[model samples]
Target: MYTNWDDLRLFLAVAREETLSGAGKVLRLDPATVGRRMQRLEAALQATLFAKSPQGYSLTDAGAALLSRAETAERAMRSAIAELPDTTDRLTGQIRIGAPDGSANYLLPQVCAAISDDNPDLDIQIVALPRVFNLSRREADMAIAVSAPTAGRLVVQKITEYHLHLAASEAYLAAHPPIQSASDLKHHRLVGYIPDMIFDRELDYLGDLGITRVPLASNSVSVQINWIRQGGGVGVAHDFSIPAMPGVRRILIDQISLTRAFYLIRHTDDQRNPRLSRFAQALSTGLRAEVARLEGLA
Candidate 1:
């Protein structure tokens, strides 16, 4: 009878990772179990496959030759693994992406570049959000969310931390109560995105500040910016977001700095898709860098 495939597979990961612990992470097994499986594979083959080193496990000559064959088998098995991340089977398709207007719209250009770079054939449908897109229902193929954990058991990757500050146009700040401290903002005319537009659960954390949400609500970030610039009100804005805009003025950077996490939520069901995986990685990477750029960290 042929040797079991699982042991060989575990051995391959150990050889590639160069540590039993690292291999266990790839295989989702305990380190001892990985060691036991490697032993079993070696015993079955009656060959010493690895020379364990202080730095890591290195494959002996026999293991090195076997590694190439194992990799081939692994790729073949991946092709047969029921689902793979790459759009290997299907060439062209659309990916529906739902995101918030504030940062998402600003960073869309950069994200488009990454997507175009990697998945030129895959079309991206940008959905504006006031409500969370239900990924379990496939409302969007993926989402850039400021969302909380949901009951559906979805996979959410935190991409970056978006920090908020109380800002106004120079004209607006000049006309409002002295915002030198948190207490002084009590009477400022604050422009804000419609409370409904904030889809993140942590947004409610803003309530802890006791700073009232300005009644002059607009659903669009541009409209809110225009209102603030025209001396309509002081508003909560991302510090990074406003540095590039010509007219917005920060009032209380220290007193108003509140940070929230931005997440990219993907379905656990589609986690194995090569195209989606690549797309997600590129999106996350671009977003992390773009946010740093926006914050002047770049």
Candidate 2:
């Protein structure tokens, strides 16, 4: 029923701040203007939307009900606005990209630098989180996930695959019993990613072999690697996650290797943006190079 979205915004601001002056400060408007706009909204709604008291203006029953509707309307507007493809020819708009920290750390710099080299006007925003980025709601223009493709209107690429292994500090290895193969691993404390990743349990790489270690776990790959470097028991982290994570040098046995894929992702909405496509290409190329280097498959 709002003829002017501005009125809804003004009402929300006043309701949130509980004072016309506070709302004005946020909206960059004078108190008089804020009050006038809110008053107009209340009059149009034909309800005493707020109670004016010595302390501040407070929402009434009517205002509280309207608040829910107004919030829904605001979210809808924001989603629509967020969906509008950046039509700027110069690639001047900002893009929010979400991905895992490890990928962000190892791969994005070169890709970002490449994007900047091509489109100096482009502004890239990176949001690295442990949680998976949402594509349906546009949480990020793009994402990088560990899992395989899902039933969404998005694009996915098997950007690269990695190998992982059990590793330990030199001192820890020297002090503890030897682990020359999967069978010997059971006898020693080792650095691990906390997955309890036994070769037999997963790849049958250590079939019928029961290996166990500490119960501790870390959400951060780097932290896990650090603990391993400090002689924490056997950890199973990606070779890439391990390089910066701990095991600064080679660790995977010549005969056994753990593997996982890195997928490049983007929402269907972002597919239309030329700059987004460009950025995706750059990231893919960079990922290929990095993966090849890490796996020695180059």
Candidate 3:
């Protein structure tokens, strides 16, 4: 059986994307062309690589075996390319980052903007979701996680420690009974993540306060913050996000405060790539500074 790096590259893309159309978007090819190449590659290897269905193409047992080797080859290719002569000083290509909504909305915009301004050739994509990203599936090049992952072939770096506090809009505070203690929270409408949608224990801010009911709940931190901004209800608000909400103020700061660390996670195999190493260093440094600067204002 004979195959080439190009075929393996296509296989990796399809495996990660789980659809010909998605792989085509990555490779800048039409779906029909991508499908033809996949067929040719499967014939060359004389193995069934994918199981197609209405949902998408899923890797077969043989394809799963090939995936590990293909990833190793991909990393090797990246390393080789990095060693080649430098034609340009600026970094080029697209890097996608997966992060929870809070950091994605309040933090990454300014930080990534500065990086993009400096490196005009680089394209940055931020994927903001409520749950953790699957790095092995290539959902993103890197992810910003609220907590450190305990297992995987991964590298986790503590980006920064940020604070959150029980807060409310001035309007909400004035309209409702004053919250002099955590117990006073019972009389007020509470806003928070849906109980079942709390992806991380660190995110169960209201639960830590011994509050079980959320009158207004949303999975997105941005939505939660907006609810507070519109005088919807009081909830845990990140200090970094408070500066963005002009009327919102932290209440019982000394009594109730939560400090959580943001972690930058990457594949262990990516450590060999110089470009990613440089980008990661820049990102970590930027986040630390931005968090401090924003929290100071809050």
Top candidate on TM-score is 3
Q: Model 2: which ten-residue window has the lowest total lDDT?
A: 199-208
Give the lDDT of residue 79 in candidate 1: 48
Model 1: per-residue Cα lDDT over 1-298, one tens digit each: 3346787788777876789998887566999999988888888888899998789888899899888777667556644652634436333566778887766567766676666766567677777766677775345778877765667748888898877777777766666556778777666766775666655556543355674466777766667767776778777676667765677777667666788878999877666667677777877888888787777731
Better of 1 and 2 by lDDT: 1
Best candidate (score: lDDT):
3
On residues 87-110, what C-alpha lDDT tens digit does candidate 2 reach at each position? 665556666678776667666666
The reply for model 3, stretches above 4 Å from the true place, is 25-29, 85-88
The TM-scores of all predictions, comma-separated, are: 0.65, 0.63, 0.93
Pairs with steric clashes in candidate 2: 190-233, 190-234, 191-233, 191-234, 191-235, 192-234, 192-235, 192-236, 193-235, 193-236
Model 2 has an lDDT value of 0.68
Q: What does candidate 2 score on TM? A: 0.63
Task: Write the residue-wise lDDT of candidate 3 on 213-294 in tens digits.
Answer: 8999999999999999999989999999999998999999989999999999998777776777778888999999999999
Off by over 4 Å in 1: 1-92, 193-199
